[model samples]
Target: MAEESGGHATTLGVRVEAARREAAGVTSYVLTAPDGAELPRWSPGAHVDVHLPSGTVRQYSLCGDPADRRSYRIAVLEQPAGRGGSVEVHRELRPGAAVQIGLPRSNFELVPARRYVFVAGGIGITPVLPMIRQVAASGIEWELVYGARTHGHFAFLGELAAHGDRVRTVPQDTAGVIDLDKLARGAAGAAVFCCGPAPLMDALVDAMAAAGHAGQVHLERFGPVATPVRDAAADDASGPEFVVELTRSGITVPVPRDVSVLDAVRGAGVDIPSSCEMGICGTCETTVLEGEVDHRDDLYTEAERATCGAMLVCVSRACGRKLVLDA
Candidate 1:
């Protein structure tokens, strides 16, 4: 898809050429340019922002092959308790429907590794599917532990069959939950990629640490992660207010405990593009010029956080009294 003339806010017009049921409560949509043209080149873990007819936007991982640019594919799991993104897609989006979408963006990039271990839960399998294909083509040894509520809920079993015994399916109804302890036992040297429900990711992270492979794992979250809530008494005792200096704009904004740096900076008449304001999208990442940041985002790796030069301004707060940002 060609980038339009809307400055950096360009959106591609795509038609839903095909929609198929992948599994129970899950459906895959194939999007292509209205004229049947190749779209943008994207990596394995990339996702596109889908703009619904109702004006509600949501991000869905590209599950199709990265080698094929003629179409962009995404799988949506009907989320009844969600804020209506999935409901709109499952109910109203159909073949021949036109929708606007952003270019592919990736926060969960598959880093080079000698070997890999992938874990997917439910619809979280979307992003991992592409990564497995890439890794297999590269001749790297890899394994996948895929789990769903039941065998009926599993998708992509036919594609995974080519991987042979490297893929393990654990349906909760029959096989019970996945055993992270056993899965992480000998996975120390391989890069581990996981995308799933928050609880599964949390358990895997903790399990990896217990198994002496903490730094070997990477994760992509489907929604906002749970951040620690600072107690009112503790925050007040430590002087909760902080100063945010927008270096490029040459403005000093006082960020009270109740206001986020993103809101405070924007209040000073500076525009910062933000999506998923809860800090999951990595859209509001800002360079840190000074001060300590209490990084609260799950987007950054340990090494990225240790360097401490960039932070997601949406949920990240100041650890010191002042923070200088290249905004």
Candidate 2:
């Protein structure tokens, strides 16, 4: 199926069946159809865009079992300093409250491997939890290195304990930070999936590279890897406007210096599935039929970027005066 688009008109309405505090400042919401009908099926490492009443949308991982079609579960960590989405989720998402959500989307997909090594930090475990369950049930050799600020900050401890020594719980206050080199060494010759804070993500990539485990490392970043969004002043000083030709839509949109390719096309009534406009999520990725792109997203790998096959319209721009997108 294609990515969810066409704005709220295409959104699915769900009622919050239950809301439980999983950990310190973190809550998990179980959403189901009002009539208790079966919902869509999703795999591990999948997330949904939650549309709040305040018009704010946030992408959250589906941590619940994929086989359970009765409902979808998503966990949210309250961020006091964030851009208000989490705050609204914490305050307004109560049991029986109606909510809208986009269909499940996955970028951090689980590949078939002889063994899997999962690394997570704090709330990063949301996506990895279901993955762990799926692999564990298969009797495959898999392990998890999960860390948080403290033991009390860790969610699903009771569940993780079922895996015994296969799960390594490291509370920074007592265990110190996870050793990247040690982790890389242990995960060599195995498929490694990591999702966490920027520090851990950056260090693990380097460590994995040094240990000659480059192709086996799969990471899902919370935000941009390097390039932050340009400021208004920076945007003003950016290159001239560019034209984007959408082949499928058969429309030509003008992308102004201060505007993104996403805003430009959406302004022209071209709806695209997008959540994090900051270039973190892969929702706005568009095929590039023709164009020199200024790729700015963390979603694509180095090999993928070298091919110039796709571009994240939310933040990436054209390298020249024109671009042809599949849309």
Clashing pairs in 1: 1-39
Model 1, residue 246: what's the lDDT?
88
For residues 214-314, could you state the per-residue lDDT of candidate 1 as single tens digits? 99998989777676776888776655689989888898999988898999888989977666777788777899999888888878767889895999998
Off by over 4 Å in 1: 1-10, 224-227, 237-239, 242-256, 263-271, 287-292, 306-308, 319-327
Error of 2 at 170 (Å): 1.0
TM-score for all predictions? Answer: 0.86, 0.88
Error of 1 at 260 (Å): 3.0
Best-performing candidate as measured by lDDT: 1
lDDT of candidates 1 onward, in order: 0.89, 0.88
